[model samples]
Target: MKRSTPQEAPEVQVETSGQLPPHAAGYARDKVRAVLGQAPEPVLFARVRLARTANPAVERPVTAQANVDVNGRPARAHVAGHTATEAVDLLQDRLTEQLARLAQHWEARRGRMPVPGSHEWRHGSEPTHRPDYYSRPVEERQIVRHKSFSLVRESPDEAVFELESMDYAFHLFTDADSGEDSVLYRSGPTGYRLAQVHSRPHPAGNVAVPLTVSELPAPRMTVAEAQQRLEATGFPFVFFADAGTGRGNVLYHRYDGHYGLITPAE
Candidate 1:
């Protein structure tokens, strides 16, 4: 008997968080669908969200967000522009780059093509999706909240799973491969990225070995489940993946104790 290949399922979904023109919504949905059609593997689903920024005069008032689910893996990207159509076009390009990389990684592993033998492949290029604010000179920013937490040991994929399943802007963990302190953070609209913490710079000008942070285990859960956990623990915030989009999100307790949401934007 011969084994049958699993069927592919690549569906595109588009919805607006705020009031949006029907043409804009349709354009976004169509763009994502056309891009995913080129994916080497079956994209489980792709979701696009469009919204207008509060600042009317902003150069990029129209924000577009796209989330792609490949197999059980999730990837997200976003872009902004003056119009929904322009934003969606850029969003498609970003999504194409992401899916291309995923395809490269998987294909290389399967020996389908010569392992990516480029300089960027050997030495990872600086991520282009990071926000512009990060490049600006550091201002008088102070650590408003400093709490020590144990560093969990996990792979990059597992780290993302943990980060999404808990209420934290970032997660510091020991890389299972390198055994070094690593930070997983959501840098702007590029989704999640990992940084290796070499050494801590002391405020007083002396280097430190860093506090022996304790590891906080995170369990994968849906957004609704995360909200329930947040309410049960009386915690200020809860982080988890949106079941519908497979994207990370934060549900926080507002001043009035009502729920507030924070999600990646372009």
Candidate 2:
């Protein structure tokens, strides 16, 4: 079936955490996390600034950004609010609905289940209409966004140290020698790298789902090496014939009832 454009899909942005004041910064920060975290864990970005809106002399508003990873392709959800209550709203309806719909696409492709929007509601299923509901488009979409992050510059040792210390799965950095953008991080059993080429433009509006991506082992990559390394892994994935105006991505997973092994790629 046809799916709505990414613009139609709620833009999923990782929470960008902003800066806070000394006396109330930590406390407010904790409160913000507690409130926003009420929803299931998903990659989010929160940009915070601790500054006086009225005073031009304030310290640059103390602007900073904090981001969490999504299940698939590390999509981000923005969580920002004047108070904690507003932050919580982003998690459930907007974030949850988008992820669920994306997952449904993958499950349908796998022939494991019906499209998420379809069900016999007339029978007995309660109105589970979630908040931040997204309308489905009317078109056939079989494939979604599938991308890999390759690494550059830092050696494997530096990459491992930074990722481990920060407790992050992947790091997007520019290569010193090749001067190209690359990703270094872990996924699955070993570390993996993707040579991000200017060729593969960022998909504009596809929703990203939370998938189980671990830091895989890797020797890091130069731009040239990463492209050659493509298709080396046996991870089975289907590419969409029509990637759409922007990058279209869906999270496919193995079925175990309602739960499935979610892969970040199409």
Candidate 3:
């Protein structure tokens, strides 16, 4: 059994879009220190974010988020409470559990599965459900976030690794061998899928294209991989080069939520 020897606690940086109360600030620092104290390796850095939320729960009107980087791996947790102090306590508990799981996951991969019945408390101890964003009204469904990154050419396996490492639900990359645009995403805890796009752009409506088009480099990949990318992104369609024939193709989502592939006939 490996134990973490405590040294100096890493600095905790707190950022707030709105003002945070002084007591809340102090509580956040203390809770973060408590969580990091249990980490297998000293946390490289820790961050706390405080924000007001629209939640109607009287006991959880504020949201707290903790992000910690440990030995190049990152773990994060979010909690809400009526008071900043309550939120800080919850966040501390969550971050501690997450860090423990991270360490255990690495260890389990090295042929050490925890004795199942011996640790019944650890089994399913964490909440597995996620809030359903679609439950919100359509009028409130506008995009609230945007992220941009360069497309790296990678295989399905490589894309899977990247997705997990970044803690993202999906990943986009060009296929190194097929020269097609592809995406990788988790279908379940134990499974992953891929999608790819067509090589050429489809006919568009009578609307002007974006004034700025990013001339991105494309990589060759399998059609199956391209299809997965198309599905994961929830895009209306995707355009990419055909890995098989090096021709342009289009993968589109149908009204029935199924996928359709359009390729120029040779």
Top-TM-score structure, candidate number: 1
Off by over 4 Å in 2: 1-72, 88-93, 114-266
How do the candidates rank by lDDT, highest first?
Answer: 3, 1, 2
lDDT of 3 by residue, 47-152 (tens): 9987654445333456777888877777777666666777777787767667766665455555566522213212232323111122333233332322334467
Tens-digit lDDT string for candidate 1 (208-237): 112222244233466568767876886546
lDDT of 2 by residue, 141-255 (tens): 2223334433246533334334432333344554344343444444433333333323222322321211122233223333223322322432222111122212211122111
Deviation in angstroms for 55 in model 2?
Answer: 7.2
Q: Which stretches of candidate 1 lie above 4 Å from their native place?
A: 1-9, 114-118, 121-173, 184-266
**Arranged by TM-score, best first:** 1, 3, 2
Q: In model 1, which range of ten residues has the least summed lDDT?
A: 202-211
Find the candidate with the highest lDDT and give its number.
Answer: 3
Candidates 1 and 2 compared: the better one by TM-score is 1
Off by more than 4 A, model 3 = 1-4, 17-21, 54-59, 105-137, 150-266
Model 3 lDDT, residue 174, Cα: 69
Task: At residue 90, give the lDDT of candidate 1.
Answer: 77
